[model samples]
Target: MDTVKPKDRDFIQTVDDHLFCVVGYLHPPDGYTAYLKYVPSPDGKWGKDGRRYSRTLPFYHVSQVENTYRYLKEKYPQYLFDCPVRNITISWVPKSHVKQYYHPREKLGEIMSRGANDFLERKLLDLSTVLEDKAGIKNRIGVTGSILTETHNPSFSDIDLTVHEDNASRKLIEALRELKEEADLVKPVTPEEKEGWVKNRAERFPLSVDDLRNIAEKRWNYGYFEGTYFSVHPTRTDEEITEDYGDNTYHRKKVVEGTTTVSDNRDSIYLPAVYGVEDSDEVSEVVSFEGLYGSLFEVGDRIRFKGVLEEIRGKDPHYRVLVGGAGSPNGYIKWV
Candidate 1:
């Protein structure tokens, strides 16, 4: 279908999903079982030799295998041939499964609140999972946004964080990833549709990040039309996230540490980060590598060691750890 549009192509990732698939029909040679599809190169399709080099032959992910016949009837309606064209199919994987974009037509504050509410609604399922699976959980994860919906318009890259649990685990992360694909996201303040209340939206609703992002995209405040979306919470703030996702048991007692990695691009080097500091009678949550860009730091050099928990990039593919140093703070302190 040539579904790859410029905006939808670059940021659009064919997320690996176990749920649904999209089968494609391509122009193939007669009697040929399969043909090598050529994806254009970054440079250009036609080279000096008028030949194309390597291309990523993407795999298709289809759904509802039981309704293959029905699917064929819908897609290939005119062709009433009894047998399905076996080799005539070319597959395109699903890319729009995340969430549909939204178009806002109201005040900016209204849009921001709507966006926040939509984000919260989407995490309801995960929150339910956390509530059901965890043991001996004491603290509650608070859900809120960085730009508190009080302004006329919310800024770009604003965040909505849901903190229903105190700690996040690897197992929990996998579960969350699964939850994202299990269903598409929904947005309130939808035009002409019956609106859902805030309570009903947040508790029972579970949405994909894209769903909330659609809200942002439609609004004018943020770089909405730019088509970028990311949500960072209080914990994800400089302090909390620097530490590993609660996998720092080795350094928990002696020296505390925290670390995070890029989602992909394993070689992508980010600024070093250090979290946890003891300021006399107080504590600093996190200190980051970018925080030390100029002052007492030089280019091509690692972040200098500071308070007890210094965030260090580790050797393992996704391993980053922090260890205790001299006079580390008590780790926890009540905010005044």
Candidate 2:
């Protein structure tokens, strides 16, 4: 079998049968850094290829991922890794344990070639085709989530699309914004949908419904596609990834609260969204592993944030605020 290089948005099945979703581009030499997503269970709600599985973590909920660490520690300790650089225990799947590698781009090609077998797949095809033409990002987008895993239920599963390359991702978002204005094929979430979204997030984050609504309104990467709820996740290509694994070591400092102006939002759409900030001497950047905060701010916007401060050590040391991880239950970034 060919050796697969895992990147963000890819999925892997271990020899022990545990399923994990790759987190980012950087990794140690011996393993792929990922998070546990699914595990086999007799009474599991999700099924793929006749096997049942249960979800271990909730989508976009960092607190839940932290809680999951306890479960993993007790049941599958091998998946837990003590990283010397990050100074944290995270999920890392050993290279030798990988039974299969599921690349989002590859799965999407297969689907597009073989054709759709159900309603959800048909909608996915239509959505991808439209995005390819309108955004001029042909072959740059891929399907993910339950659809990629072949565990989607046609009745309720939402479409999850992944776009590779940072520039293409931004272009796609712009295209979606234009499409929403031009046609009904693509539209922002309805009031009802927004209400549901706000309510769901309010339960997990410290933000209120109004704050969540305001953030949701500013996003263009997720909404309704032909009446089906869908989300577009942007992944950075190898060329765009600047830091290598272990280049910078992060050490937790203390909880911080302050207001700052967003100076740059170029990399705000990607996972572990990074933001350049000004008007704050203590913090040079704000980094979030939580998906909710991605693309939530714009340049020149003033925002207040509460998160853990970290001291990054390398050739040039700096301070950054990290949101959405273990021990950061109250962490949040909101418009001022």
Candidate 3:
């Protein structure tokens, strides 16, 4: 069997049946830096192919990731890795331990080939087709989340689409924004829905409801399709990934708070959302790994941010403020 390299938003099933979702694009040669998502258990709520699995990580929060790290440290130490470049201990699945590799693009093609078997599958096809026709996005979209794993509940499982290629992803969001205005089927989240989302997110983030609302308003990736909740994740293609693994080293400095104007936000849609700042003596970029902060800002938007300052040592040395995932609990970027 050929070795498969998992990219961001992809999932990996270990030989021992543990499920992990790949993190960033760059990874160690020996293994992938992923986080545990599900584990097999008789009492699990999710079942597929006669096997039941329980979710270990309920939410994508820094605290939850830490809890997962502790759980793995106690029981599955083999999956833990002491990363040298990042200088942090994180969950890593060795290449030799992988039994199955799941790619979002491939799974999407398989589904599109077989045709829909249920209402959710039908909706998935309709949604993808609409995006392709209306947004000029073709063969660049994929399905993720529970649907990708074949454990989706047709009655309630939310649609999670991965839009590959940076340009297509950007175009998809732009089209969705316009579609909401012109089409009846595509609509922005209702106030009641926003309230529910705010309440759910308030437990994880430290921001106030008003702050959350402000951030949510700018999130073009999230909304509704045919009255069904859905979110579009922008993923970079292989060619779009400029930096390779071990290209640079990062050292976490001290936490810093400041206000800066956003100079560019083209790459802000991806995970580890990168934002170019204008006229900053200490830092030039603000990178965030939290999903809530993705696509949360625009060019020329002045924002206040609190995060860990990181020194990047490579051919071009510079400083950047890192938000989310071990940065700091209070780390955030908001309108200034």
Candidate 4:
């Protein structure tokens, strides 16, 4: 079976026939195996009446396919792992995974075909138009999240936009800043929403209301528009998306599991997202590749995390416990 590359959404099946969404880039360092985040399994074993069965939990945290299978066998030895997606044969675990590639142009066409009154449709069109006209890379923006999955409720869903090229991403960030100030098209988030956002984020990490707002205010790529939240995630163009890190090589080291205290999140808006942590291990920073958790963790709260550790050796030897390295569930955060 072919590997699941970046920008692809996959429906993965385990040996027990349980299904999950591969939430991010699926090409693990070793192409033969996959590292995946556990989504609410789309299993119909439980009745799916209305929205009652829409979500399920006790979700297995991020794990490799074989590891998860082994863990389960120890608990429920009678359960068998057999189901595999197309083109994959079941080994101890199935090698097959089902994936759907994300096409920005095709998704844009679908959104355009919707009538004018559709809230999400109008928001997407306006944002794309602004980025295209100002940055000249309109065609590179792709929709993700609820809108991309077609499960969005126009009245409630926020816009999740992707800018494919690095240069384009920089331009989009600048453009978004200007839009928030001058364009009536993008509106400021209501005080109520801001309060709700602060409270919700504080519960996960220990940050004050002001600290949360300060980080958010600096990020030009996300804001409120038309009474809804929107975020622009910028990723390198296909040609630039490589895994090489030169002399600073990395690997999937032992999972660092502990409760640590957060000290700072002032630069929470950027990549290799950092937070000063202490009284845990030698690890000084909680670096996250996923943007969602960048601002999610704040100062003072006791956070429990398990992630791939990358250690740099030299005169200045230090460690970084990377969270959300491959996005949610595969990487995680919780206030203890």
Candidate 5:
């Protein structure tokens, strides 16, 4: 049987060969189940050179799946290619039905060891050089996203950089911010690029375009690298990977919404970024396994949020609404 991990992307021929982005701690009993993250489009709307394009797919709620499929069928029918819509979220394909699996770290290692061959790869190398010179993050960084799969169109693919280790990640981010401030080290996003990002975030996130632009501007980890967009993220080191969290089973409880203060966001860089909440009866904490939403909030921002409840040990333990799942959908945080 084919095995996969979080952040891996796979293709299913039964579903028009669209790429599904796997999320959550997968415990698929029969086959892999994930969210429909992207579809192949000849129009090049998703990327240059007719690369796969992404559309907004909601979280797996059984209830929302049908509506999502209808939206796709009506809005993106040309790309549908007659694939069954039910297969978008929880549908399983047997081991033999699996086609290809893309591993992020392995792909990053390949680019790092072999050197870049295309413009996107060269941009990554350029960014790496700057990071190495400025932040000492030469060996500690890896690549993720479309490039990791080798299907990336160099002209349109984004450079998804990941920094390992808590200290190094923090350092890398700090360096990126400093680079943006310096102006000479990195190029600024053009008006067109800024608008594109705003449009993209507006399509995928619940935040308004202005709020997203604000968040995007402050991060400094994303922007143009030789006219191509790139973003820097953090991951756990091998030492930080934990397999000791006892036997845990998950059940969807309810849709939770609240306005609460964040007591802490120190763990924002890690997966399932945990934040301690204060003065809220609905929840004691909020967690986002989705990386983008994780860092959106900070200490003291009263945020409006919605997500599914996850009961951790089932004995008055701290329950959290998982904000990121499936296609990185089902949850959003907005400034109040």
Candidate 6:
């Protein structure tokens, strides 16, 4: 069904059983290096290649990955990975391994990647199936009282992760509900309480938190995570827009009457010193000053405000800044 040709490239991969990072060249007709940017991070913690907690393959900026790849290849040489990174050989750590650090999702990823999708995500629809297919889970969500929500829409920047409790023992979920303070992601089967999702070569890869915020602030777009699909959008959905504002009250202030000026040139202009109006409150009330000047003058010529500031009004380049002598009852627009 897919029209796009399958991309093939050999790789020396550094992976955590299910979590993996492979170094390879992105094929192209135009010639460009790519960077993969994904992984779960409340604070933009992971890179694109599923290698988190460190600087690994950045899927977007592919040009700069040579050094990272070289280091990984030289590090792990025993695992006889496929020519292009397919089957991984590492399995089951020794009891004397003395595990200190906790990484819960790694185990979950391993289970899911190892033909256990039934109990993993179940195509993001059937948690019971994820349980049924996973040998360790036994076809039932083991934990008690958990919430699952499927999301498949994301902006260019968003970290995606999946949470499930099918394998967790009865004792674990019962104890989890009783606790207070604050807790992150957890599944009784894995050591880490939280973990992110990773795909060896998924299109529309997941992004970090910083990247997501950057996309939201700078790009004003939406992203998603559902089943195995990652989606990005140019404009945010209504739900996302509401999340940003954090309220249900949606209303537009109907602008009744206002003057307007449009220009893209940097030209000098003189604003006549008006009488009466010094404070911020007074400036806001002055209806005539709604949309007038390009740059308000102070003495001779010193551009005050600079930025593509917007406050509705059909996407204006800037907004009027309150400028005047402090506490003065009468003032004029001067340098702001």
Best-fitting candidate, measured by TM-score?
3
Q: Write the per-residue lDDT of candidate 3 for residues 1-336, one digit (tens) a residue.
A: 235445678888898888888887768888888888888899887767888888887778777777888888998899998787777787889989998787888888998899987888888889888888888978999888778887677777789989999889878988889877775767788778788888898877778889898876777877778778888898988778787678888888888989999999988989879999987778999998888888888899998888989898985588999988552556888887
TM-score of each: 0.21, 0.94, 0.94, 0.58, 0.70, 0.19
> Which tens-of-lDDT digit does each residue in 294-328 have in candidate 5?
56677998888888776655333557766764333
Model 2 residue 216 lDDT score? 73
lDDT of 4: 0.54
List pairs with backbone clashes in candidate 5. Answer: none
Q: What is the lDDT of residue 210 in candidate 2?
A: 87
Candidate 1 lDDT over 1-336, as tens digits, reads: 233211101111112211111111111221111112222244533221243322222221111222233543565322222222211133323323322211111122243345434443334334433423542232323323222212112223233323321244223333333433342331222332212322332332233333333333232111111122322121222232233222222122234433222122211112222332333222233332221110121222222222243232232122222212112332211111
Runs in model 6 lying further than 4 Å from the true structure: 1-4, 8-64, 72-120, 123-214, 218-336
Point to the candidate with the largest lDDT. Answer: 2
lDDT (Cα) of model 5: 0.62
Q: How good is model 5 by TM-score?
A: 0.70
Clashes of each: 18, 0, 0, 2, 0, 31
Q: What is the lDDT of candidate 3?
A: 0.83
Model 4, 1-336: lDDT tens digits are 333244333234344333343333323332222223232335522222121112222322323343554644665333233322111211122343333333444576677676434667787887777767766665777776545544456766678777766677767767777777776767666567677767776665444566667545554667766667887766454465344213233444567777899988754544445678888768887777555565566689788776767675533357878875532245555566
CA error at residue 316 for candidate 2, angstroms = 4.7
lDDT: worst 10-residue window of model 3: 1-10
Clashing pairs in 2: none
* Deviation in Å, model 4, residue 81 alpha carbon: 13
**Candidate 5, RMSD to the unseen true structure:** 6.3
lDDT of 2 by residue, 162-226 (tens): 99987788789989888877757887777787788889888878898889989778877877776
What is the model-wide C-alpha lDDT for candidate 1?
A: 0.25
Ranking by lDDT: 2, 3, 5, 4, 1, 6
